[model samples]
Target chain A: MDKKKDILSLDEFSVEQINEFLIQTESFAEILKRDIKKVPALRGKTIINLFFEPSTRTKVSFEIAAKRLSADLINFNTSSSSLRKGESEIDTIKTINSMENDLIIIRHSDSGYINYFAKNVPVPVVNAGDGKHEHPTQALLDLYTIYKNFTNLKDLKIAIIGDILNSRVARSDIKLFNKMGMDVKVVAPSMLMPEDFSSFKTKFANNIDEVISDADVLYMLRMQFERQERKFYPSIKEYNKFLSLDMARFNLMKKDAILMHPGPVNRGIEISGEVMDIETLNKDKIKINAQISNGVAVRMALLYYALS
Target chain B: MREKATVLNSDDIERIIKRISHEIIERNKGSENIIFIGIQKRGVPLAKRIKENIESLYSSEIKLGKLDISFYRDDINEKIKSDVNITEIPFEIKGKDIILVDDVLFTGRTIRAAMDAIMDFGRPKSIQLVVLIDRGHRELPIRADYVGKNLPTSLNEFVEVKLNETDNEDKVSICWI
Candidate 1:
């Protein structure tokens, strides 16, 4: 597939593509450590962050990535866009998309709508987070962080804990990590598990200790209380009792296994604060920060590779 | 059918590299603050050759670094997927006279990207470009500081540099359709 046209999902990415991206991201990560964190790769180009959903982390990282690449940027959140005045989503996006802009980073609440925008627009489209469908960039940054730690992705055991039915990050991560040859498994209650688990090289478990005893990486997805999915479990306390990453379960994990979460932790619900605080990654920083730091590099790689 | 011509033979390659090394020493005044940072593939061998020549001339050591400008290129973001190479600058470049070595100098964009990539490492006191062949058709305002051979060409022509370090041979050729 022509990734430069649009980076819509991880499914279209091959092992060569992912590895190439990770290698390129290593340079961007090194750039982040320098006194100057900007590059002139996309100087004459323009980028628009057309985020229909509210986001502080993803949107900010993308903005930083674009700015670092010297691309002209425009931020478009739904509340400030024409969609606030009863304008159709497609119409609002199309109206703002002119010949001046070179790329559009879109985040919408509707699944698979990125393809609609990519089809209608002539410029490149990057899927920031499209509903519960996929968050390709987030998945990429996560993979970068993990790849940096483990050095290799194949045959490694990755335990993805917490909400599975509603996390956009988990959706992309499963597809990508699997494509990279990792043994990925989901640990969630029956209600939180998706109806189909046979689509990829993934396993499902209703208990945490039963699945993570030998896991090399522990990835946590937020409980997604905001999605407000109905009565998955009796209560937060009960969910924590059964599935949360407490000290006991944490000890069961491989001593050097990485702890990762796409930030804004639930504190006491999906993962315990104590377990999440044990920082480990580049320069001894927490994995969450590492993930955030990596987001910029990975996005820079994507933007530079897609636009260069 | 296509037309082909041999530009520089193996012995010519060695002699030109030796001459370029001496010229670099003469211009940079003894190669004290200078380092050779090669572009990927063939540039590495050319840089190494220059380094060896300089080392033997004055019996002095000089550092060598490799700079890959794949992602830094302007056409890297096009529809086609290109191979990404690794950049290894083992030592610092700040305040030193830097010489960027490459095999071909046609569009000048690759060297432009290399200069930009070098800036990210640190501000080098000065930067110079050395090319084995300078087939003149520049899209940007760029000119090499040193050249082995200045071969003029049209837009449709391609310069092929084959060296022992990468391709299992030693020669420079030109192809035209």
Candidate 2:
């Protein structure tokens, strides 16, 4: 019932709580395997998905999760709402809260939007993603994928490559991985690196080779070229030269090193077509698609722990 | 002397369970074709205990199952908050004599809801209700076949049955509204 104790960061939960959440998630996973994959856990509860920016996977995944838990869901987009007609974010959220929503899952282009809204709202606020700030659930699912594979995170090396400054995924992953005792290294061009990266306790690598050697997991992030108003590089060819994960670089990685991508990838821009087709790097090899299923599990755990 | 409805202690509940186990064995002529199904949260552990007790007396194991009747409850509109731990029915139940166990039996609405939920699984040969405490004020004709203790009370009074399996305590008390 305490609204101030919301899950703003993965670090707020202790290892025991995390493990308990995972264990409960396993039960939900088992429940999902049934013919009728719905539970009455949140039957009468209402969840509102408010996305200021456009999204497909995160939006649908959350909708499916709510349905599976038997919670009534309402999805709002900027295009369909009065926000397009110059309505303020606070006014929109206030209107939704007045209608008796139990929870709100928000994705916004503005930084601190979710945090600010969470402070104002009485219901629990879940951050789906915020502008280059944090995507804690995505990071949790990513870490969950790694933990499922390696069985433990202690001392495991993970390399997050490409566009660190523009990636909310990278920021969240760095925080969660460090909290879980993983050795995290961020590989990005100096221009794309955040100025105060030292606070995250992550090692910076300008060269992928310096970090790829001992990595247990290689997380490739999609470059936000579409978001950049001006070109950050001379050309697409020049950008690929410094950042792309080609076949050669893929071969250099440890054989057991698992590959991960928060998708909607630019195929040849961030990752090579050859490397994407690699038997070990593909979805069939590591079952990264299962991470989508794990997203539901993790979210189910979060809702259950917070509301139940 | 006026008959007073007394509170049942933890030791009394345990003793009742032992007697119920003996009665089940004697009635069934052995634990064959018998299944113990507990209604959601509180009934689950109670069913397991009853099954364990039955197994100890008889060489063969008695099948145990759980029925979560939250979705089938008639008073769905009365629930203001969501319960995160949803019900899960784990096994098949067809043509089996089911002992539906619950912590307390009051107005019999929970039992009625449970019956509707169980019918979805398969046809049971028969269902015999069992409860730790039966506080009499039945709105429905539903009755427990095997009750640990029965207390005659007014409709305004509330009977709270606490079990160690769920509530972290094992006692039954009657409190006035």
| lDDT (tens digit, per residue) of candidate 2 on A11-57 | 67887776656555655665576556776667788988889888988
Question: What are the per-residue Cα lDDT tens digits for candidate 1 across B1-177?
Answer: 254899999999989988899889999989789999999877888999999899998999999988777646777345323455667786889999998999999888889889888998899999999999999888899999899999988878888888987888998888885
> For model 2, which pairs clash?
none
Q: Candidate 2's residue-wise lDDT over B53-171, tens digit each?
A: 88887778777777666555656545523332344556667888889999888889889978876776678888888888888788899999888888877877777777887889888
Q: How far off is residue A285 in model 1, in Å?
A: 9.5
Judge the docking of candidate 2 as incorrect, acceptable, medium or high: incorrect
Off by over 4 Å in 1: A1-4, A280-286, B1-3, B56-59, B69-84, B107-109, B116-121, B137-145, B152-156
Question: Per-candidate TM vs. native?
Answer: 0.88, 0.75
Q: What is the DockQ of each candidate?
A: 0.31, 0.14
Query: What lDDT would each prediction earn against the true structure?
Result: 0.83, 0.77
Docking class of 1: acceptable
lDDT over C-alpha atoms for residue A25 of model 1: 80
